[model samples]
Target: MLPRIHSKGNYQKQAQGNATARGNTARSHSSVRTTDSSKFSKLKEVLVNNLLKDYHRKNKKAGNDAIYLKAVEEVEKILTHGRLTDKQLKDLQRKFSAMDGIPEAAAVSDHAEQDSYPRRTEVDEVNSYRPQPPPTASTQTSPSKRRKQIDEWSVMTLYNDVKHYEEQKKMKEKVKNEQQRTREELAAQIEERKKQKAAVKEQERRVADEQRKKYEEWQQEMKLIENEKLQKLLEERKREAIELKRAQDRKKMQIEEDKKMRARATMEKRAQYEAVLKENEKVLERKRQQKQEERELDERLFRVQMEMAERQARTALAAENERARREQDRQLRLKAAERMGQEMENKAAEVERNIEERVQKAQDEQYRRDMERERNDRLRHDRIVKENNAFLQRQIQMQEEEKMRRKEEERLLAEEMKREAEAFKREQQRNKVLRHQQCMQQKAMLDKQRMMKDYYNENESAMTEIELRLNAPLLKQVVQEKPDLPGELASKINLN
Candidate 1:
């Protein structure tokens, strides 16, 4: 019976041991489930907080706050899930630490409600439940330490990022202001260049104006010179014409003088020819008078010779007749001789008377011829004497008249010479009067001066002597004498 009681005790001990093993397994499984749920919830809370902070930081960098809020909503959706991978947990942890402080739970809840619908699930239980454990000094210290570390990392990263972004913004603003100032400076430089170009153009215009004025002045001077030259040339031509006219006048005067000389010569030659012709005519008249005288004398001589011949013949005839008558008477005379002798004596006496008468007639005729010839000679001599006497009288009259005219001329010349001498004497007398007047004036002046000088010396004798000599005249006497010649002889020596 003891053996059987021992076996039953062994079986009861085996069953108790199996029950304890099973209980331990179930407790371990429950613990694992709780831990997993707790871990997932923690990771979701980290993701949500980290996402919100990341969005704020990104928005600040991008300058777009609205897009940052949208990113936070997506994080809330992941936080509502009950499970998460290891990579997701690590990313959530890094992002959350970058946030300077934990985000508000109310803010996450309000955003989650606006974006998601409500639901009932096992994941919800894990999110809503809180775990409790017995407090220890070491455990409390560890959790506080971990939270402080995360907070410090977040504050450091946020400060550095915000500071860097502000620095970049200030640099960009400075660069933009500098670009605007440079543009203003370039515009001012362009305006200055335009002003310089205008000034240069004005200077060139002034120079051109000066040159035009100088050119006009030069043209005026040249015109004046040309006018002067033309005037000079005209004057020279006028002088030449005047000289030519003078030369022609001189030649004409010389020709007239030569013609006058030739005319005078011709007149003289004609006067000489006429004088010679008159002298020849007078000689021919004297020869004709002499020939007539000779012819008259020849006629008288021939008449005398014929008268002598006739008387001789007559005497001869008378003698012969007487003889014949005597012979006859002789024959008869014997008877009467005694009676006729007385008659013969008377006849001889009668013949003697007749001869006497004839001789007287011849003598009378010769006396008449001698008387006519003598009368003619006397008449010719008287005529010659009368012509000579008249010629002499005319010559004497001409000489007397010429002598009278010469004497008259001499008398006129003497009167003129006397007048000229009188005029010369008057001129000499005038000159003498002037000289005397001047001398008197000089003497008066000298006397006055001398009187003054003498008065100053208290003496008047020098002036008194000079006055007495000026008033006195010089004289000379002539003695009379008797005439040495007789009155008649002295009268014949009358003064010339």
Candidate 2:
């Protein structure tokens, strides 16, 4: 009972502790939400500034400057109010975006002589307080300068966050300390109560012990008085007992005489009753044996029927498990076959396309080679014909020269032969250049053929290896739990 009370107190304290912890958690979450909201407001400010800058750039008319100033003034006024709900903030942002440098027209159209900032409840407006922005801008600049300013703003925001974090940390620590102090006070009070209870229980036990001792002393005195009265009564009772014993002896003799007379009268009747009781006992024994045999037969029939039903149920369950296993296996195999078929088809098409490209390239190269050979043959035939005609003319010139060998000047002849030598040397150089070009063309063609062969062989080997892997049997898991298939099921499967 004492332990139950202690546990109850401890549970109550623990529940309080849980509640305190939950409150702290909620406060922390609320603070986080506040910080997020502050960050959101900062982002909104930056977005609005950027929008203003863009608007100022697009609408550079002198007439629109007043409109732009009014929009900025109204946005600043909206910010000067207390914290806005998401709906209000969204409405303000949407209105600003759709202003189109015409805030007065929209404001007047809705409500004449009304400002852009909407009104709120009087009590709430009285209670509201606004915090100033870190900074405000009204002009455009190059992106680099704007980016630098944004960086500075980010650092400022970070510093503020750090300060807030420190404050929250201190608050959490203070809450924790307060909770600890309360728990300690509760524990001390509980301890004091336990001590007080112990002192009271000790006093109660001491009093009970004293009362028990007093009761024993009173009982001893009463017993002595009872013993004296009982001794006097015992003497009186002894005299009365002697008188009653004499009267009982006379009554006993009369009862014995009456009993003997009754027994003598009923002797034949007693023998008849004994014979009937023995006959009844024999009939009851025969009936008991018959009932026992019938009960045994019924039990045997019930046990046999139960055994057959159990076997049938187990057999059907095993059949169902086996059928499900077969079905799953069939589905798995069908998926594998389909996937492999697709992979094979893709590989075959890729190989066929590659082969076609290689064949086309080879045919083009052969045609180019045939055309080059035919052009070379025609050029050789023309060169030979020119050489034949030139040789005939040279023979005629040589005969003329021989005739004029003694008649012509030696200087003129020598000059003519030198010119012929130069012409022949030029022709030989051109032929050498042509041969070099032909050799280079053959080398390039050979290199292309080698590269194509290498590419085709590599692709074919890779595809063949992939096909082999796909054809390979997948690794199958072995079931250690052997199926308890019915013998009849196995026989039927074998027959099918």
Candidate 3:
């Protein structure tokens, strides 16, 4: 049927292809046993319909898994070899119709050709443990031959049962582990992204803070420079005022000296004028005009001095106000910067917390999903195994009953055999007890080995996870250093 399945596709392809122009040659499929076009066409239709039926399960959706893909490949191989018989094709069709995937028969047939699913090999291994049928009474010739045989490796029989249970556990655990690893990887990736984002934000914040600090320092330096300029201007203004004061004093002194000299000259002139009273009246009038000019000059000097003192006082007050205003502005800037720092810290911490919560949620969801999947697999496997065991038990019981029936009639005539049988039964009981003990010991050892294997596997996975995390930081650093590089290139650097 495998070849026929492929031949069906081939025939259709040929019919639609250039081969259709030729009549007899196109109708004949040399690689397959079924040369009849109509029967072969029916075979293909039946195979496709059966496969579709199997794939269209509970949800009425059709899809392929590993088993389906392997079956297709098997069909292709059968066609390629041109060795498929009619019997194999019919058997293959029956299997596809009866099973959702390959059956034990198909697996056995393909074992010599391909090893697709190895677990099916265990079906034979498990069957090997069935106790051999007891020998007939006719074969019992002597009492010495009746002693129970105890093989050294008889423990293996009991171990086989444990092995099967462990195999089932391993299968379920394998799928669960794969899902767990995927979840962990996803979570790690998310965490890594969060870390990178935070780190970048922090770096940017630091850069901005540094720029702000530098800017503030520059402002302070500029403020100090302005204050110095104001101070210099105030001192220069004071110096100008004092120079004006001195100049005014010097002018006043000069006026006083001139008056004194004029008065002295007038006194000398008055002594001379006593001789001539009429000539002296003109000198006295000139003296009065000089005194009026000196008085006016003194009043102007006093007014100038008072204005200079007021101007100096106003300049000092303005400089003091500017210093106070600058100090207040500095304080405001420092408070704002401190507030901004606190806000940034709070925001970063909040983002970190939210990310952690999200990660924990996802991890829980993944763990739940893995547990559910593992449970389903174990349940399904156990059910199938139970059915198979029940069927085998029925067959064995029927065989035992048939053998017992056949020996019933001969039991009365075989007196010597009855005694031998009694002895053999006693020995068999002893052997059974011994075998049970050995099997228990073997089970213990196997369980221990399984535990160790599981422990190591877990450790290996943990180490792998740790390695991934360790590499993430290096990768991030690489990306930061060469930001202009393509992302692929940057990641590859750390990967290497």
Candidate 4:
């Protein structure tokens, strides 16, 4: 009986150990499943974060429709493949909002708007029809009796909400991006036009400079030619003036020689007249009446000679007057040539002055044009830079607004998920209590059946004992009791 009791205790302990092992195995499997789910969740979070960062980083031209659409597609793929819950979606939205720096006020208003969606009504309806466990008598549930349940419709609704939010965001971003691109294109076109205008102006300026340079070169050549001609004219005038002076000196010398010759002839004529008178006087002393006629003739001849001399002197004087008139005319011509040369010199000087003025004026005009061009270019560049800065500011503002909107959506989602989770927890608690009650009732029934079976077994054993005593003598007469066998034979018989 002791060995039998000990063996029975051993069997009970073995059964209990097996039950504990099975529970531990179940717990281990559940832990492994939870660990895998946590890993997947972390991976999903990391993927979504990277995607959000990529999208946000592409704020400039990289934020064009193609990249935006690609990012959207990737997000959709993640959503479809990952099958994240509302909580997970909310977390991702929150991450996006955080990265983009969303405002809380906007989130509140968006949440209010979100509550009015038709899907929320569907979710509420589903919530109202939550499955209740059958009635039970217990107020507590056993830990072992607990089980997990999921609501597919609620998950689907949350997925739809996430998708709807993403779609709206995508649409807004697309429109904004297009407007930004258009503005940028317009600015670019304006810049290009300005550049073209500047290039054309520069070309014109270069051409003008070349023309000016050529004109200046031509002016120098003309100046050189004019100066050469003036120099030649002056040299020619100087040579002619020298020749005129030499000719005038020779003419004066010839006039003086003519005067001297005229004086000598007059003296010779007077001397001859005196000699004729003296001879006539001597002849008169010899023959008074005869010499009278001769003296009268001589006197008449002297008078005739005097008249010729007077005529000759008058002729010489007229010739001298003629020469003097010719000298006066030559003097007037020389004065006129000198005056003309002076006037030409004055005209050449005036021309050089005028040319200098024109060149100076052109240089000043070019300087003014260059300065004006530089000023215009500076103004244009400054304006472009200012516009670009304004554009960037506007883009940043829009991004902030978008972030606020996302944050609002995330907050609403989180609230809804929290409410659903609380409700689910309550339901789980109620179900667990019901299961515990059922398990208790089944265990009580099994205990009652086992007690009844033990009672019957004890009674049968007592009756068998009494019958064995009553049949002891007859059993010995009818059949001899089997003798005990050796260990080896007993073992072989038992095996057989």
Top of the candidates by TM-score: 4
Each model's C-alpha lDDT?
0.47, 0.50, 0.51, 0.51
lDDT of 2 by residue, 1-496 (tens): 0011122355476456556646644532321223442554443345345435544445432213334345444544555442446676566556545556555566456444335556543222211212433433532333223221224445555555667768878987887787567666656766676687568557756755675565567557646755764576566456656654664565466546545654553454455445544654565466456446555654565455545545545554564455456556777665555565566556555755665575567557656766775576567657755765685576557657754752454456457657755775686577568657755765675566557556644542231222223222210111112245566533333333
Q: Residues 1-496, candidate 1, lDDT per residue (tens digit)?
A: 0001111124245335433544443332221222322554344344544555554444432212222343334444444333458787557655543544334564476557757965533332343333323435765566433221224333444444345446645764565465345334433433453455456445544544554465456446645754675576567557756764675466457546645654564455445444544554564466446445644554464445445444544444454445446657566653344334334444444555555565556557656766775676567557656755775576567558756865786687579758866986797588679757866875686577557555644531222222223212210010113356556424433320
Q: Once model 4 is optimally superposed onto the true structure by TM-score, how far is the C-alpha of residue 289 displaced, in angstroms?
A: 7.4
10 residues in a row with least lDDT, candidate 3: 1-10
Tell me each candidate's RMSD, in Å, in order: 56.8, 75.7, 63.9, 55.7
Give me candidate 2's TM-score against the actual structure.
0.20
User: Rank by lDDT, descending?
Assistant: 4, 3, 2, 1
The whole-model C-alpha lDDT of candidate 3 against the native structure comes to: 0.51
Worst 10 contiguous positions by lDDT, candidate 1: 471-480
Cα lDDT of candidate 2 equals 0.50
What is the lDDT for 69 in model 4? 29
Q: List the residue pairs that clash in candidate 3.
A: 1-89
Flag the better candidate by TM-score, 1 or 2.
2
Global lDDT for candidate 4? 0.51
lDDT of 4 by residue, 35-108 (tens): 22234323433554455554454442122222332334445445433345667656655544344433556545
TM-score of each: 0.19, 0.20, 0.21, 0.23
